[model samples]
Target chain A: MSEPNIYQPFLMRIDKITEEAPLVKTFKLVFVNDEEGKKFQFKAGQFGEYSVFGEGECTLCIASPPTRPGYIECTFRQAGRVTGALAGKEEGEIIGFRGPYGNTFPLEQWQGKNLLFIAGGIALPPLRCVIWNALDLRDRFKEITVIYGARSVADLVYKQELEEWAKRGDLKILTTVDPGGETPDWKGEIGFVPAVLEKADPICENTVALVCGPPIMIKLTLPVLAKLGFSPENTFTTLENRMKCGIGKCGHCMVGKYFVCKDGPVFTLAQLNQLPPEY
Target chain B: MIIEKKLLKQDSVEKLFAKLKADGRRILAPKAQGDEIFFEQVASASEMAKDYIQTTLSPKGAVFPRVEALFRYQMEGKDVKIENNSEPQPTVIFGLRPCDAASFAILNSVFSWDYQDSQFKSRLAQTAAITVSCSRADEYCFCTSVGGSPGDTKGSDILLTRIGSGDYLAEILTEKGKAMVTLAPELFAEAPSEDKEKYLAKVPVKFDLKKLTEKLPEAFNNNELWMEQSLRCLGCGACAFVCPACVCFDIQDESKRESGVRLRCWDSCGFSLFTAHTSGHNPRPVQSQRWRQRVMHKFSYFNDRQKYLGCVGCGRCSRKCPADMNLLEHLKAIAEAR
Candidate 1:
């Protein structure tokens, strides 16, 4: 064959396994081959097709930031066949990953602007890549703020990382839980993501907001952002569509004329408005 | 692309088949299977179906199989051993329609558009098409409406049109066809004064393709129209299964504890599971939306992205649809929709 197989994945060994939540785990995977590891590169917000050799592949974001190299991390909730198999894997186990697919967040455009990140529940992983990216290059941006919420305090992923971000002086992090989901010793806000975002009321001028969450959270949060004077172009989000070949060939990820794998997983609110609600 | 046409005596077809076999190529041709015709391996030209207007399934499987093993794997002590699927056997599609022949490029545009699927590429490289022009067409045939005709040669390495006097007018289209001619130099003769079109089937245009493509984007919001059109749809996927240009597939692995093979099998957009997320939230939840997607992808989305229409106007889909969901009628409805 003149060309190599596109579906063939790079073999990665699970370096570390962190139990982020009840059934969610973050796997820090390193390339099995040192040469492959040094050559590998990916940006924040791009996703991969994680494979459990016996099971099929699942589309998940590179939850880890690009600032750190040598390995990539993926945070997934044990929801499906592939994820269940992935969660069952122990550290040092081998897995397959065909990756860095789809588009990335244009962080260069957000430089010198306030970066506001709003995330809900399991959707936090995609945004966490950008949140850390912005934090790593803190001097490039003006103010960095994170308002992350979930169904409950127990359900929030990256618990240790959240505490670390909260301790950092360069950024402000506000964690929240749904009204009835808070514990007696809970220290964060008690409300849904939209309500919590509205209560904070951050300034919208020269600011770019990245929001990723459940459909309802997104639907409710968009209007709140608009109310706070955030324009459609200033707000960015990523879309996750069912994919087989994550490289635009498989017709599953098409949203109208655009392939979510090609045109974007990242799009402005204005771009989303032009597309049909297929995703 | 330049075309070199020649006339072959009626007796020369069987001789050419012998030559192809001698060239170490497996010939795939349409054969009768009960009532339906499907592409099957044949030893000689005489075994090929003579009266079929079109096969029940496309000859696309010659290049892209229904289920192809992408890789074979075995677990070692702590490492995994991977092996790419071996090269596909050289194949020659003996007698496919021009419409089905045209589907190869559309499929090629997809598999090679971004990341080259070498599995598909290798198969295509090893395959050559010898298309037989239609002498008769049925109600479902719409080759002309989609910029094709019974005599149109798009994807064939060699196009054979039956002229008067029971002879064949062969158009050597590619290097593969030239190579075949070299194998049996005596069979191909000087072109006869026979126009291939005179003997070809006349499939009148049913709907204006340009109008249909333009109207489809605007009509995408009309879910009620899709519902009405696809009311009888069972989502059986026979249409997509038989379609020449439907390239959607699902990757799966079947293992026997120690070893396994990863296969990419044919999948359809009409299936509910095609776009269902693991979270149980499906993007295309209803049948109407799926039907709409099938139409829109072929008419609008594919045209915009791939620079090629996804439908080949082969009519296998309309003929194989168990629901009797006539694609032509629906397309006409979409074209005429306000």
Candidate 2:
């Protein structure tokens, strides 16, 4: 009875909120307890269970980079009941958070390799953590290229960050929208994510690829990456199964023998190949 | 832990029950409701159900409630406050079968796997299991095939088996059991001369559990096998509800504007929505896949990860199944398959 609760969450204050897209918004959260804030740590691929008091908890990746400490950010669309509850809140309001769960992306192993980030729609938040981390430590890696796409120009999240990355001389950014999903003045390429990735074919040797997107985007992009000589081991992605506890218990998320909350939210394509297609 | 064997007179059971009740411990024993039996709190041993192989539902609700409050949350102006669930009362589950008793360990393995769950831990820690050995088993019983027997004292505080003289052959198996003796030591007599096995039920090993576990991973993609086995499956979730070793759950928030409690409720893999995402994507969409998950998770996944099998061979699912889906027959078929 004296043990600390695994279900109880830390009180987090919403310090800042950004309206990223039409329905997508990001909240920058800071721990209300100063001691708890100082002790909190998470890696790139890890996620958390964010609660909205009246509504239930939602499993969301810590969208902000671990390299930039002191605050954590989460971007979500007004999709479901929990997410709708989350989106209703404004800056300075409080929410409940408990996490930093799951395995981290092996950033130390990919230190000297070129980083290729391919993301689609809302899935970009999960990959953006590692993308920003790799960019912040730009001197440690080679050429970094990002190919991001959405259903339409209005659907693309992190617009400001995409603009900032495009202006950065060190990085290569390619933005795309689906066929016929472009606005009249849309400057980005008009195509699906896989086509944009195939068009902007970067060399695959000594490169590490991180892909996160809808199921269809992943299904189509994997062959494209494989054709470009990126082996299964060099390709990585984070998986999201419907989870409740966001821990090993509750038993909502599993991809074969592995507990996605414990064994991974992040897995190499080779590792995923070893598992059954349960997620 | 070493177990000390002793004899408990049939009349002494009532005395022990009284002593436990007087000691401020809540005693939950099987009570017959119409034809079905359930675990409920009783003041006297006479209220205990007679001649029941297993309860309609496993005594799992004793250690893990059907619905439990994980935490309480309150909205205070712009801030939200969190409250940890309070500790449970000291509880003793009496007259559970050995199969039901053994399931507590499987539940323990899951709750304490990597991140220890305090709510489950506290509930389990405060609860002690006292099991009665089964002297009679129906066709549904298969505990022997799953590495357990009617007289198995694996997960019991005290294990009691009725001998030739109708007296209980008591195995004081744990400190918790000894504590009950400490409350009233005079009630326990000298050890009985009768063999405890003579009084227990004979449950045959219908299938090879080791072979079944080994065959599960190989049978993962055997769509024909799963589809055939699950053709009659209603996806009713009755199997999980009656299962002692099934620990899957769902977390939800129940609120009335300002104050709310986060509840952990029972869930089953067989339910389609159990693995369905909000984006209209379902990984295990079909009943056959869900059936395969139930089989694979219990036999293959739990053994590989937790070092404990997720089924105790209680066969409550088969007994209570509206579809008359015999799990023993299915398991035997899977094990004997080429």
Kindly list the per-residue Cα lDDT of model 1 for residues B1-338, writing each as its tens digit.
Answer: 63688988888888888888888889898898888888999987888787888888898888889998889888886688889878888988988999998999999999988788888888999999988999999999999999899998888889998887888899999998898899998999999877787899999999999889988878998878999998999988889999999999899988888688888999999999988998899999999999999999998988988899999888888888888989999999888766
Task: Judge candidate 2 at residue B280 and give its lDDT.
Answer: 80
Off by over 4 Å in 1: none
Local accuracy of candidate 2 as per-residue lDDT tens digits, B1-338: 54688889999989999998898899999999999999999999999997888899999998889998888888889877778877898899999999999999999999997889887888898888889999999999999999999999999999999988888999999999999888989999889677888888999999998789878889999999999999999999999999999999999999998999999999999999999998888999999999999989998899998899999999999998899998889889999998
Docking class of 2: high
Reference-based lDDT, residue B264, model 2 = 91
Give candidate 2's error at residue B274 in angstroms.
Answer: 0.2
Q: Which candidate wins on lDDT?
A: 2
* Model 2 C-alpha lDDT per residue in residues A120-152, reported as the tens digit of each score: 999999989999998889999999999999999
TM-score of the B chain in model 1?
0.98
Clashes of each: 0, 0
- For all predictions in the order shown, the interface RMSD in Å is 0.9, 0.9
Where is the poorest 10-residue window by lDDT in model 2 chain A? Answer: A249-258
